[model samples]
Target: MKRILLLLSLLTIAGVSAAQEFSGNIALESLIFSEPGLDASQMDDNITLSFKPKWTGEWNDGDDAWSVEIFLRADNRDEGREHADIRELLWLHLDGDNEWRVGINTMFWGVTESQHLVDVINQVDQVEGIDGEDKLGQPMIHLKQYHDWGVLDFLVLPGFRERTFQAAQGRLRFPIVVDTSAPIYDSSDEDNHVDYAFRFSQTYGDLDLGVSLFKGTNRDPQFDLGPGIPHYVQMTQVALDLLLIADDWIWKLEIIHRDTDPSAYQALTGGFEYTFYGVYDSDINIGSLAEYSYDSRDEGQRGVFDRDLFVGARLAFNDAQSSELLAGIIYDTEKHSQSFRLEGNRRFGDSWKGTIEMQVFSNVDPSDPLAAFEKDDFLLLEIARFF
Candidate 1:
């Protein structure tokens, strides 16, 4: 609460001194489960109300600027989902060919749609969603340089944000709840550990390539049994991502090699998407996607996508309403488990939008990591009003 107040105060002061822009949205979300939870404490339905506001101010003839975005949520069923975060609060200075950013920010660095194997800068906001796409902001100093050959990015992260988890009463959770209060760390510095990352990206002909190196505490944590306490470890990672664009086809690939305390592993995800314009002589576009994932880690230490295949389709109605739908399924070859997801959204007028999503699990093996979610199929509906 204090941090929010301070940020608001700062924004207010900046707004009074310079020309500022303000925008935001308020959303209401509802989730309904298809089956009962494993525990009696979990609810079959949940509701959440969220607000996100953004403010930006430019000074010194647009050479320097400040941006602030805040997110707050209130959940009716799960206390763990009722939280707040500073999505972005940073000051940016732009020179002729260089850029500098300091403060809390979010960075993304992957091209694969099924999984983001190389995006390790920010911690995952687990309570926000199960897809692992949401992230918590990190405090860092980022420097970027534009050269003739490529673009160079260097980041010095000073503080780490721990991953969030659901409460015991929350649905879509593990059989044994994770105790977020007592986390163990391999480094004695714990959350104060400093991290560094460097990336070089360039485009050649029809292909874009990015290579990155990171040395720091791992964002993903392993769990200790009996109490389900998270254990963070120090590690180093080298990653590469590529994207190639052809007439109507797009190819994406992401690979990573991670070196940890006791073991090392390599993982990769590669996919292709092909789009057909004016489908059926209508103003609709359809796209087909296929992706494969592989991991060299042992079964116990691997994630659900270790040896999986993903196939999906995307539909876009090029209308004034901006309607779109995406549906996909991930099939685990080793465990024979399957996960299906569908998401669709449409704009309702100019200021309102509606979205619907569904998640289903099928043929989940008992030994698989997704076994806990076998009975947790859910449907979500959301409505948002933008200002």
Candidate 2:
């Protein structure tokens, strides 16, 4: 709370002395499940309201800038789903080809469409969803240098934010409640443990490559199921991400090697997306996606991407509304389990937008990792108005 207040104070000070830009949105969301209830503790109704606000200020003729973003949600069904977070609060300094950022910020680094296995800088806001796209703000000092060879990013993270989880009343949760508060760290400092990372990315012709090394607590924690309770086990990870573009074909790959107590393994997810441009000479564009994921671990995989195949499509309607649709299915090859997702969004008028998302799970074995969500298929609808 004190850090949040300090960040707001800085934003106020910056706004008073420089030109400021403010924009954000508020939204109403509803989630409905196909089954009556997944468990005894499941909520009957799923509805929520969210508010997102952003403020940005510029000074020194654009050489320096500061920004803040806050995300808040009020869920009527589950207290765990109702949350507030500082998504970003950072000041940036730019000098020629070098840049520096300080304060809390969010970073995303990966090229795979099905799973972002290489993105480890920020903790996952798990309550947001299982997509692994939403991330919590990470407090850090970051530097970036650009040169002919590539771009180098160095980060010094002073604190670690543990991943969030769903409460008992929340939907789409595991059968056993996760004890998020009890996280065991390899480092004694726990959340205050200072961590560091570096990444080098370059583009050579049609090929783009990135390699990163993180020597700190892992963002994704392994849960220890002892006596029917859960606890986080921290570890370290090294990752690589790459992308290749050839005309209408785009290939993406992400690989990671992790080291944790009692376990060490490597994982990879790679695929290609082919676009059929101007389909039938129409303005619409259609794209097909295929990806495969592999984990060295046989049965204790934390995610659903172990030994799975992902197939999907992207649809873009070049219309006034900027309509788009993305549909995908992740099939567990070994267990014969499958998870499907369909997401669509479009703008409504100048200041409003709407989104609809549907998720389904099928053929999940009782012993599979996704067994908890076997009956948790849900559809989500959201509409937002911009400032």
Residue pairs with backbone overlap in model 2? none
For TM-score, the strongest prediction is: 1
Q: What is the C-alpha lDDT of each candidate?
A: 0.90, 0.86
Candidate 2 segments exceeding 4 Å error: 1-19, 225-230
Q: For model 1, how does the per-residue alpha-carbon lDDT over 91-114 read when each residue is reduced to its tens digit?
A: 999998999999999889989999
Indicate the TM-score of model 2. Answer: 0.94
lDDT (Cα) of model 2: 0.86
Q: What count of clashes does model 2 give?
A: 0
Pairs of colliding residues, candidate 1: none
TM-score (all chains, Cα) for each model: 0.96, 0.94
TM-score of 1: 0.96
lDDT tens digits, residue span 188-284, model 2: 8878988889999999999999999888887776655453244445567889998999999999999999886568889999999999988998999
Residue 27 lDDT in model 2? 98
